[model samples]
Target: MKKPSRDFWKDSAFALASVALAFAYGSLTWKRDLPNLFRIRAGRPLAEQAQEPNPSLKFTGARGRPLRPFLFTGRTFDVFYFDHVNQPTAEFARATLQATSFTYATLPFANFNQADFRGSYFERASLRGADLRASHFAFTNIIQSDLTGADLRDADLTSARILLTKLEGALFNENTKLPFSEAEAIARGMKRAK
Candidate 1:
């Protein structure tokens, strides 16, 4: 058997060390850097993109479970529960996730812009600073949810059951459709967007 050269061993060690260093750097900065890495382009219609499956678009759910990529439209997520997990900064722009359950999920600053969430459950979910522009929430249950600073411009919330939900600093414009009166919406601390 032929012996390996000394230079080959040195190169192999260098490659392994480089891989380890990259992994450590990613782990240290993932929370701060991951959101910037996956930015959704604005003003692009969902129909403009091809319906091909994107394997690179993966999300982590509770207990490190892999979630379905948010690129697929009209996906029914029955009983999709996330128990008290902190999934801040999740991006679900232009996706359809109907009838999903988000009880006790902490998803502050999540991007749900133009997403169809009709008939979804958001009981006890923290959606502070979430970008929910032009999203659908018809007949959805939002009991005890925190929607402080959420952008609700042009979003439809017709018949949405919103009991004890926090709406402080939430922005809504004239295009936003709501089941209740505008006065009541304002009384709930939801501000009118200029």
Candidate 2:
């Protein structure tokens, strides 16, 4: 058998060292550097890409299912339908979630304090035990949605269309503004918060 040349061993060592260095670098900067790679388009540098208005990123969920992309603006979600999505205990305090749909979505124990939900739809959505303190629900539809044990202190629901919504044990303070009178709200199973 013929013996291998000295240059062959040198080349093999160089290739192995290069791969190891690349892997180490990638592991250290994956979070910051890897996202920039995705932003680049058509051989253009990342700097050339226009800065997005919102820092929040858009992502797709549920592979192999007919689901739309979930776009976020800070803590806000504009004009998106989150039907059948299960996101319990989610935090969205002081968010501006305008014109969104939460049909059949499970959002129990979610924190939506002071959120603006104007013109949103909440059909059959589970918002049990949610913190909706000071939230705005103007012109929104709350059909068949569950608000059991939710906090509605200082919340505004003027002109909100509520139909068959469950408000058993939900808390509402004196500062809470509703579409109906306090007596009517109490008749609908909403409790006054201490």
Candidate 3:
């Protein structure tokens, strides 16, 4: 039998890593990937883009608690950041914020309802079920934030980027401020807009 060569594992790992990098890069370069990449890059830490997200640094939630605004009183986080917080559950809900730069935070379930997230950058944050009702997002940079189930009732998404995403469960009433055509369609439960 032939003996296994030295550095075999290293070479295999390198190849695998290379493949993963290529795939990720390819996905990012695609038109559909631009918004997400921009969102993630924008929210990256000033020191290191690859730094592991530390929710503890700017937040005061238990290990098991989700990333909710009510739970994260006076906490800090944003769009262009890496949010390894709540990785196990991948949740951030009901969080109150103001003038924070979250360009690319990876908050899949970030609940932003009833929270004050004015001037926050959610360009690429995954805002699924992030109840944004009665919140003020004026001039908030939400270029590519995922609004799949996010409730926009009474929320101000005016002048938001509103990139390609799902608006299935998002609510927008007269009290809400929208981007005219798109917002109107979304408010009426229209699909295929995002």
Please give the ranking of all candidate structures by TM-score, highest first, separated by commas. 2, 1, 3
**Candidate 2 lDDT by residue in tens digits, 16-128:** 99999999999997755554456311322222221335433322122223322222223666664555656667677888878877777777888898899999999999999
Report the C-alpha lDDT of model 3 over 147-175, residue by residue, as the tens digit: 77666777776766566556666666667
Clashing pairs in 1: none
Residue 194's lDDT within candidate 3 is 22
lDDT of each: 0.73, 0.74, 0.54
Give the distance in Å from residue 156's predicted Cα in candidate 2 to where it truly belongs: 0.4
- lDDT for each residue of candidate 1 in 1-194, tens digit (9 for 90 to 100): 99999999999999999999999999997764563366321212222322315422322244323233334333434423344446567677887767666777787888889988887888888999999999999879999999999999999998788899999999999999987889999998999999
Candidate number with greatest TM-score: 2
Rank ordering of all candidates by lDDT, starting from the highest: 2, 1, 3
Off by over 4 Å in 1: 1-60, 63-79
lDDT (Cα, 0-100) at 15 in candidate 2 = 99
Better of 1 and 2 by TM-score: 2
lDDT (C-alpha) at residue 187 in model 2: 95
Candidate 3: residue 121 lDDT (0-100): 62
On lDDT, the stronger of 1 and 3 is: 1
